[model samples]
Target: MTKGGMESVELFTSEGKGRGLKAQKEFLPGDVIFAEPAYAAVVFDRTSTWATTTPWGATDLGRCGWKAAIQRGTWGCWLAVADQEPAVPRGAREPMASWLGLEREGSGLAEGCLVSIDDLQNHVESFSEEEKKELRVDVESFLEFWPPQSQQFGIQFISHIFGVISCNGFTLSDQRGLQAVGVGIFPNLCQANHDCWPNCTVIFNNGNHEAVRSMFHTQMRIELRALSKISAGEELSVSYVDFLSLSEERRRQLRKQYYFDCTCEHCQKRIKDDLMLAVKAGESKPSAEAVKEVVQLSKDTLEKINKARMEGLYHEVVKLCRECLKKQEAVLGDTNIYLLRILSIASEVLSYLQMFEEAADYAKRMVDGYLKLYHPNNAQLGMAVMRAGVTHWHAGLIEAGHGLICKAYAILLITHGPSHPITKDLEVMRVQTEMELRMFQQNEFMYYKMREAALKNQKIHVMPEPSNETSPSLFHKKE
Candidate 1:
C-alpha cells in the first residue's frame, strides 16, 4: 500500500490478531517515535448518533465493507433498502437506527479516508463494582461505523467513544472537534494498554500540529519502541492517567473488558488486597468487630486525614500522612507509586516551613521514585524535578541546584512545548536564578571593598547633602 510519498503501514497479524510493535532501532527517552494523523476520528459529543438496532435492516448495505464486518462480528443488524441513491445533506436527520456512516463533502473527500486493518483491535468495557451496581448490566458501550462511501449517509450519523480517555495523548485531538487527516500506526502504539506505572510511552511527531517533533537525519524509514527502559520481552504499557480511577477499579475494568488477566505488579497487588478484604469481611458476619475495624482503617481514617489537610491543619496532615505511609508501606511496599505522592506532599509542607534541606532530600527521593516508575517527560515528574531543584537552591547548594534546574527546564521543553503553562513557569525561574546569582556576586564585591578600606585604616569621607536653608536670604534679613 502506497499513497504519494507516505509509507503505507501494513499490519503484522498472527492468527487473525494484531501483535505489538517491534523496535527498528534504539530510541531515547524523549525521542519522537512515530506520528500519523488519525485515519478516522469523530469527536465524542452529545450529537453522536448511535444505532437503535443493528445495521442489518438496510438493503443497500451490501455494497459496504462495514456492514460485512458487522455480519462477521457477534452483533448483527437488519439491512435497509434505499428507494433512491442516498445523499448526505447537511443536518439531515439521523434515522432512528443504530450505527451511522461518516458524512462526506463529496466523492473526492471520500477517497481520502484511512480505515486501518487493526481498527477493531480492542473494545471498551465497564467493569467497576460501582458501575455494575448502578447499571446491573454486563455489556458496555463501543464505537462501530461505515466508511466514507457507505450508503447509510441519508441517516447522518457519527460514531464516538464512551469514556474521557483524554484525547490529548493522540496526535489527531490537539483541540476539541478539530479533525486531522492521517491514519494511526496500526497496532504499533495500540497494543500498549493503560497503566499507572507504565514501562512504555508514546511520542507522536510528524504532523504540523503535533506535540513534539524529532527530525530524521537520513532518508531512512523510522520504527518505534518503548520510550522507557524495558526488558527483552516485556509487555508494552502506557499510562491511563486521564481516567483517574483507583488501582483496584482500573484492574477490575481491565480484567472484565480486555479478557487477559493483567499480571502487572500493580494489578497483582490490588487483587491481593481485594481478596484479603473479602475474606476478612466474610468472616466478620456483618456484626464482627474485625470487619468494622477494616472498613474504618481503610476509608474512615483516610477521610479524616484528607479533611484535616483540607482544613489547613498542616501538623495533623503531617502526622496522619506519616502513619498512613507506614501502614500502606507494610502492605503496598515503599516502592509503590502512591507512596511517592504521599512523600511529595510531605515535602511541600516542609518547604512551607522553610525547612529547605529536609524538603530537598524528600523531594529528591520522590523524584527518583517517580523516574523509576513513570516516563521522565510526564508533567508530574517534571514538577517533582522542579520542586527538588528549588528546594536545593533554598538550602544553599547553588551548583547542585543549577544542575537540577537545567534538567527540569530541558524535560519541560520536550514534554510540554514553549506554549504550555509549565514552560512559561520555567522561563520565570531562569530569570529568578540569574537575578539571585548576580545579587550574590554584587554583595561579595561590596564586602571585599569594605574590608580592604578598614584594613588600610583609610578615612572614607561620605558626600554631603545640600543645606535646605537659603544662606543669602538669612544674611539679608540681618541687614
Candidate 2:
C-alpha cells in the first residue's frame, strides 16, 4: 500500500486484478514516477558452481540458475544461528520477512522465523493440487535439512516463503547490462500491475560503471519512469514478459508464469489483426517442423554472432549477422521478431564500421520493425531512429537525416529525459544535423541565385547594343 511519496501515482485495487498502483496525476514521458530501495534484498555471488566444467561434463543452469541453491543455503544458515540464540522479537527478524508478510503471517510460531501459515494458504490456493504436492516436497527438504528447535512450524510455512520469493523477486543485475548478480524484493515497487503494452519502465541505478565486480559492494536503487504520457487515474503497468512477442505467445506466457490472462489493448488488437491477416491471405499456420527449424536456426546464428562479438571479431560478426538476416527474412518476413533482432545487430555493427549507406539501410529496417512491434514510446524505437538518423547524416542525406533525428529527439525526450546521457547525445546530433541542413539550404539558394544572374548577363551580352545595331542594319539595307 506504500505510495513512496509519488504525487503522480497512488495505490488502488484494479478490477479483477488484486491491489495495484494507478496514476494520481498526469505524467509526461520520462517523468520519474517513483524511486525506492528494496525493503529486503539478497546479493548472491556472481560466480556459479553450475557454470564450472568438469571431466564428467559442463554443468551450467540457464540464467539465475544459482538462485535456488543460494536460497536454500541462506535459509539453512539462518535456522542454525537461530537455534543457538535466544528468541528475538518479531520486529527484529530479517527485514525481508517482515516486508513480505512472513513475520505477520507466522505470528505465534515458536521457531522457524521465516515460516508463515497464512501466506502459505494464500500461495497454495493459487496452484493446482499436483503443483501443491510437488511444492510441499521441495519446501520440506529445505526445512528438514536445518530443523528449528520447534518442529511444529513445518512445510506449509516454508512453502509460503518460497512462494513469496518466487512471485516477487526482481533480478538485480550489474551495470554491465542484463547479467543477473542477485535478487531483491521491493514490496512497494511490486504494486504496479502487468500490461502487455506497458506505459512505465523500471530502471536500476546501481553505479556509473557498466559492470560491478561484486554485488555485495553495489548499492542499487530502482526508479520507475513513465514511458509515455499517462492520464490521471490510469493504471500504472509494466510488461513482465517481452513486449516484442506476438499476442498469442505473450498471453500463453502470462498465463503460465503470472497465472492470469492478459486483456491489454495491444493483445486484443494484435490477436484480431493476426486473425484478419490470416483469413485474407488464406494461409494456415506453419507446420511444427518448419517452426522448429526456424527457431533452431535463429538460436544457433545468434549464439555464433554473440561469440564473435565477445571475441572482438567484428568482421565475422557483421558477416554472420548479414547471412542470418537474409535467411531469417526469407523465412520469418521483415517484421518478424527474429529478423528485427538481426537487423538491429547488423545496423549497429555496420554503423561502427562507418559504412554509412549500409548502416542507414539496416537502421531504417530496424525502425520499421520497432514501429510495428513495440509500443509508441518504446525506448528502442527512439534508439533505432537515432541510429538511422546518424547514418543518414553521414551518408549526406541531409533532409532525411534531419527529419529522423528530430523525430528521435522528440521520443527520447519523453523516454530518457533531457538530463540522461542518451538524451544529451541525441540533442547534440539534432543540433549538428540542424546546422548542416541550414548550411545546405543556404548553399543551394546561393547556387540557384548565381546561375539566374549569369543567365541574365549572357542574354544581355548576346543582344549587343540594340540602337547602334538597328541603325547600321537600316543604313546597309538602304544602300
Candidate 3:
C-alpha cells in the first residue's frame, strides 16, 4: 500500500477492471489527489433538448438523476462541441487532455472525441430480461423526441451511448444539496474504482458555498480528496453510493449500477453492520417481533416524511417525524438509519420553522449518531455539526453553539479542505461565533439582547404574522 518515492497518481491497468487510477504518493486526510474538470458537462437546456410540448408540459427532464435526459444532454453537448472551431488557440488544453486520455486529434464522435463513451462498458449482461426490455423502451422514447442527427446514430450506437451514461455519468449537485442540476463525465475521476468504505470523495468545487451554479461556470470541477490517510501505491477508491444502507444493500446496488461485485474490506467483513442495524440500547433489547414491526414502521414514516417535504407540508413533516422519532427512540438504536433519517428531517424542518431549541436538540442527536457511523473526516457529519451549531446559536446557547461550530470547522478542514468554499464559509461562522461567545462571556445581558434581536428578525421572516386584535378580558364582564 505504500510506495516509497513516487510523486503523484498515475494510470495503471487493473487485472480485470481494464484501466484505473492509482495514487503514487501518500495522501493524508483532506489531501487532494488530483482535480479534473468534466470532459464534457451537459447543461440542462429544456428548449434545446426537448420538444417542449409533451403531455407532461415543460418538465425539467434533467433534474434529479433522470437518465434519459442525461443522455440527451450529453448527446447535445457532443453535437455542440463537435462542429465548433477551437475557441482557444490550438493545443492549449492538450497536455492535461493527453494525461487524462481525452482525445484531441480526431474529428466527430467516433474518432478524436474527448468523450470515451464508445469505450465505456454498458454492463448489458448485468441486466435481467425485464430490465433489458425497459432499457430498449427508454432508448426508443429518447430517439422519438431527439434531433434528426440523433437518428443517424441508430439504435445500437445510441444504446451504447446510453449504457455508458448509465455506468459513468456523475450526477452533479450544486453545493446546497437542493437539486441535481445536470450530469457530467469526468474521465479522470472515473478512473478511481468503487469501494464501500472509500478513502476519497469527489467534491464539486464552485468557489461559492451559498451560490447554486448551472454547468456553465468555469469553476465547476471535481476534486478527489482523501477521506482518510491513503498510502502511496494504493488504488484510489470512492463510494459510488451513500453509506446509509447495509453492506448487502450497498453491494447489491454496486452490482446492479456499477456492474462490479464489491470486494472491499468493508463489504467483505460486514464492518459496522451491527452498529447500523442495532436494535438494542444499553442492555435493553427489544423482542424480535417488536423490532421487525418497528423497522417497517420507521421506513413507512420516513416515506411519509419525504412525501410531506416534497408537498411543502412542513407541519405534516414535523408531525410524522415526531411520531416516528418517538417510536424509534424506544425500539430502535440511535444509529438506526430510520431513526437517523427522522432526526435529520426533524432538525432541518424545526430550524426552518424557527423552532431553534428543538432543532438544536434533534441536531445534537443527529450529529452524535452520525459521528459514530461516519469517519472523522466525513462531510455529512461536518454539515450536521454546522447545522446544529447554527441552531444552537439561534436558540441562544452561544457557548455550546460556538464549540460545535469550531468542531465542525476542524472536521471540514479535512473533508472539504481549507480552500473549499464550504470550509471558507465554516471559517467565517467559526470567527463570528467566537467573537459573539467572547462578547457574551464579557457581558451576558448586552450580548443576549443583540442575539435575541438577530434571532427575532430571522423568525419574523420565517414565521406567520402575529394577530393584532386583543382578547376580551373576563373582568370586563359582559352578560
Candidate 4:
C-alpha cells in the first residue's frame, strides 16, 4: 500500500480498486489519513457547458480541448478521461464519434462529456425541473447536429453533463469577467463519500484563493474510528454529510445529481433514526423539548442579527454571535454540531471585527472541532488552520502566527504540492516574517540603548560632521 510519500495503504489501481490503504491501528473520527492537492484544474460553467463544441471562454483550452484534456495525465488507476476522439478545429474535423455530452455504453463509457474530476465524481441522478428543461434543450440542440451511435462498436456523446447539472449542479458565486477564483474543489475528494452523521468534511479557504483543506480533530482523537473502521488493509472512508438525507426524495435527488448511493445509517432510517440515535446516545436531539427551550431565543437573536446586519451594525452582529454561543452552549451543550453554526458565525464576525488574534483563535478551535468530528485531513479543517494562521499574523502575534502558518504550509505542500497558491503564499510570508522579526529586534535594542543613556545622564550621540570618525567626542561643541 506504500505509494507516493505515504508509507501505509494501497491506493486504488487501474486494474481495479486496489486493496487501498489499510489502517494498521485504529484512528479516531477526526484523525488525518491522507490528502493530495489537485495537480491542475480546469474551470467550466453554463456558457461553456458542452466542452467539445464552441464557447471556450477565458479558461485555457488545454491539450486537445475538452475530451482530450482529461487524458493529458494519469490520475491514479480506475479514474480516466472519458474515451473520445480528438476534436479538430472547425474546418479540420476528425473522423470520430460525435463527442458533446453524456452517452451510454456496455460496461465503460461509450461516450461521456469532458468534465472536471470532481464534477464527474459527484454526479447525481435527479435534478430540478428548471435544470431538466435547460438540460433537455441543450441536449436536444446538440444531438440535432451530432447524432447517437447506431452500431455495437459505436460511440456517441450525449448531453448528460447538463442532466447531471440539472440534478445536483452547484451554483457558483457570480464573478464578473475574471476567472472564478475558488470554485470547483478537486474530484478526488468526492470518493471520500457522504454520511448523515459524518466524521469528515471539506472546506474552502475563502481568503487564500479558496484553497481547500482537510483537517483532523485534535481534542477528541479516539472517537473517529466509529465513523470509519480502518483494518490493516482498507481504503480510508470519511463521512459525507450532504448525502445523509433520510427522505427517499432527497436521496433520489442527491443520487441523480451526485451519483452516489446512501447506505449510511442515518439515510437508512431517515429522521426517526437520527432522532432515536440522538435521544438514546444522550446527545442533542431535535425534539419538542429541545426546540421549545431554545427556539424563542434563537429566533429572537437571529431576527435581531438580521436587522443589525442590514443596518450595518457589525459590532451588533458580533454581540449576537456571542449570545448565540452562550445560549447554544446552555441548551445544546458544547460538543453539539449546532455550535458549529455559532462558531461559524463567530469566525465571520471576528474576521469582520479586524481582531485577527481573536478571529484566528476562534478559527483554530472550530477547525480543531471539525477535524475531531470529521477527519483531520478534511478540507474544512485545512481551511480552518489556514484561516487561523492568516488571522494570527493579522492579530500581531507574529511568532505564534509563524508556527501556525508553517504547519499549513507543510501540509499544503504534501497534499497540493509545492506549486499551489497557498504554498507560495506561505513561503512569501515566511520571508516577510523573518524580515519583520529582524526589524523588530533591531528597533527594540536601539530603543533600549537610547532610554538607558537618557536615564544615566550620558549624552546621546550622533555621527559628527565629516571629521567625527577620530574625534574625541562626537557630541562635544567646538570650544
Q: Estimate each model's TM-score.
A: 0.46, 0.61, 0.78, 0.48
Model 1 per-residue lDDT at 327 = 54
CA RMSD of each candidate after superposition:
20.1, 20.5, 12.1, 17.0
- Candidate 1 Cα misplacement greater than 4 A, ranges: 1-10, 14-27, 36-101, 104-118, 121-237, 241-253, 256-259, 263-301, 308-319, 322-339, 348-361, 371-379, 391-400, 410-479
lDDT of 1 by residue, 362-406 (tens): 777677665655446664466568778888876765556666777
- The positional error of residue 267 in candidate 3, measured at the CA in angstroms, is 1.3
**Number of the predicted model whose lDDT against the real structure is largest:** 3
Candidate 2 stretches greater than 4 Å from native: 1-8, 42-46, 49-155, 173-181, 205-219, 269-317, 327-333, 351-357, 387-406, 428-479
Residue-wise C-alpha lDDT for candidate 3, range 410-447, written one tens digit per residue = 88887677777778888898999899989999999999
Instruction: Identify the candidate with maximal TM-score.
Output: 3
lDDT of each: 0.41, 0.57, 0.63, 0.40
Output the TM-score of candidate 1.
0.46
RMSD of 1: 20.1
Q: Candidate 3 overall Cα lDDT vs. reference?
A: 0.63
Query: Per-residue CA lDDT of candidate 4, range 1-479, in tens?
Result: 11221333333432232222334444443334433333222222334322221222122232232232221112311111223434323211111111211122122322111124323421223445765465455554443334334222221223433332222222222111112221222223433444445443332222234211101100001011223334454445444333312347546744544545666555576743242112213554556676556646665776786677667786877888787767665555333344554565566567766655667767666655554453334433444566677676666666666777776665554333344455567779877766655655678666445545654695533211111011121011101
Between candidates 1 and 4, which one is better according to TM-score?
4
| Candidate 4 Cα outliers beyond 4 Å, as residue runs | 1-161, 164-233, 236-261, 264-292, 295-316, 357-361, 430-479
Please report the TM-score between candidate 2 and the true structure. 0.61
Q: For candidate 3, what is the total of clashing residue pairs? A: 0
After TM-score superposition, the amount by which residue 185's alpha carbon in candidate 2 deviates from its true location, in angstroms, is 1.9
